[model samples]
Target: MTDQRWAGVRQRVEAAGAGPGSGEVFGAWGHKWVVEEPLTRGELAELEAQTGVRLPEEYRAFLLHVGAGGAGPAYGLFPVRRVRGRWRWEGDGADLADLSRLDQPFPDQGPPRKLLDDLLAQRPEEEDFDEIEDFDDAIEAWDERWEAVMFTPERTSGAIVISHLGCAQREWLIISGSHRGTVWSDCRVDDADLVPLLDDDAVPVRFDRWYTDWLEGAERTALSAP
Candidate 1:
């Protein structure tokens, strides 16, 4: 059944690659619509065993039937590779995922709304400071607090970063707990908390939908390129 669903995925990606302006898409230069080799069942098992968590089923099938990773949304999916006999994913900010804690439930909420708002409110404005050095010092202290709240490992437990959108933005695939199988947007770089990617109906987007939507859009962009 999974095989049936994933049928032609590689072909579709290839067809999209043939489009004249495909390279014009944001982050296309990184992957160039090139899908990597799929993983064997044994390799997949090894990865799961090493991580101590089963990957979302849809994404698992993708690694088996489509590609391990490549030519995805934004800059593209981070490719998982064997490094020095250990499996790990490679890409910008990929290290942000705490693989050792993949079994934990991804926190439903980040720091309290009031706390975030207070921190933002406290962000130093250069115009308010008589001395530039004072402004820099104030902003630096505020940033440390903000980072402590936003970038902690507990915030993203059970998630694997799947793609980097550049500028410190990325997407996550939830691998455990209630939200497992959903794709989430990471916009903490822009001072927003991680949120689930939503479909047109406002439902959370799953791994398969996220990839296929990007693939379809990429194909359209490619085919329409002049």
Candidate 2:
């Protein structure tokens, strides 16, 4: 997708009270970006079926109505982050970057790792959809339903794992349990906790202007930490 498409969406999001990406709460590392689509039940099922990841209850609830733009949860807005400060990341999924390696690492992984795996993939074919070229395109198409990560024990040399979403960290979450018994839960990014990450005087930048400023020097010091 062209940057033009995202540019329009970004403006619409900011106009709709979305904040630029900040390290605030569920904000991405640097610039804040709005989630392209608000997740729904039908969408959720599609993602689960495709990735074989049973999303966490909290996340599923959040997706159903929370944090989405316009007075709902899944409130798509990720806060804009600052240069340098002390921040604490807690939870089992916090440093789980290496976990994606536990996956089968292919497009159409055959089945999960249980007897149910065969049963799960046994459903008859439905209407087909064309796959996109990459993540950005998938987002542009508002195709978040296909967003899932799948891995297996024999393939990953361990257990089965999955994630309902994928991000830049090379991170993959296990939405469901693995045959080897790995399970995951997502931690909420609390505002009371995130506010302290910034100095008392951190200022907001125009959504259009923040990302460049972030790339120039604002994020340098922040990225220094793990």
Q: How much RMSD separates candidate 2 from the native structure? A: 19.7
Model 2 stretches astray by more than 4 angstroms: 1-31, 67-170, 178-226
Predicted candidate 2 versus true structure: per-residue lDDT over 1-226, tens digit per residue:
2234123433433333333323432334322334334455676675445544454444344344432222111222231111143211122233333333333332223333563344335432323335434544534443222122222222233122122112322212233233222222221121010011122365322222222333323234323343
For each candidate in turn, the TM-score is: 0.97, 0.27
Maximum-TM-score candidate:
1
Clashes of each: 0, 22
Q: Which tens-of-lDDT digit does each residue in 1-226 have in candidate 1?
A: 4487799999988887887878766788999888999999999999999999999889999999998999999989999999999999899999999999999998887788998999899888999999999999998898899999999999999999999888898999999989999999999998898999999999999999998898888888887848
lDDT of model 1, residue 148: 95
Q: Which stretches of candidate 1 lie over 4 Å from their true place?
A: none
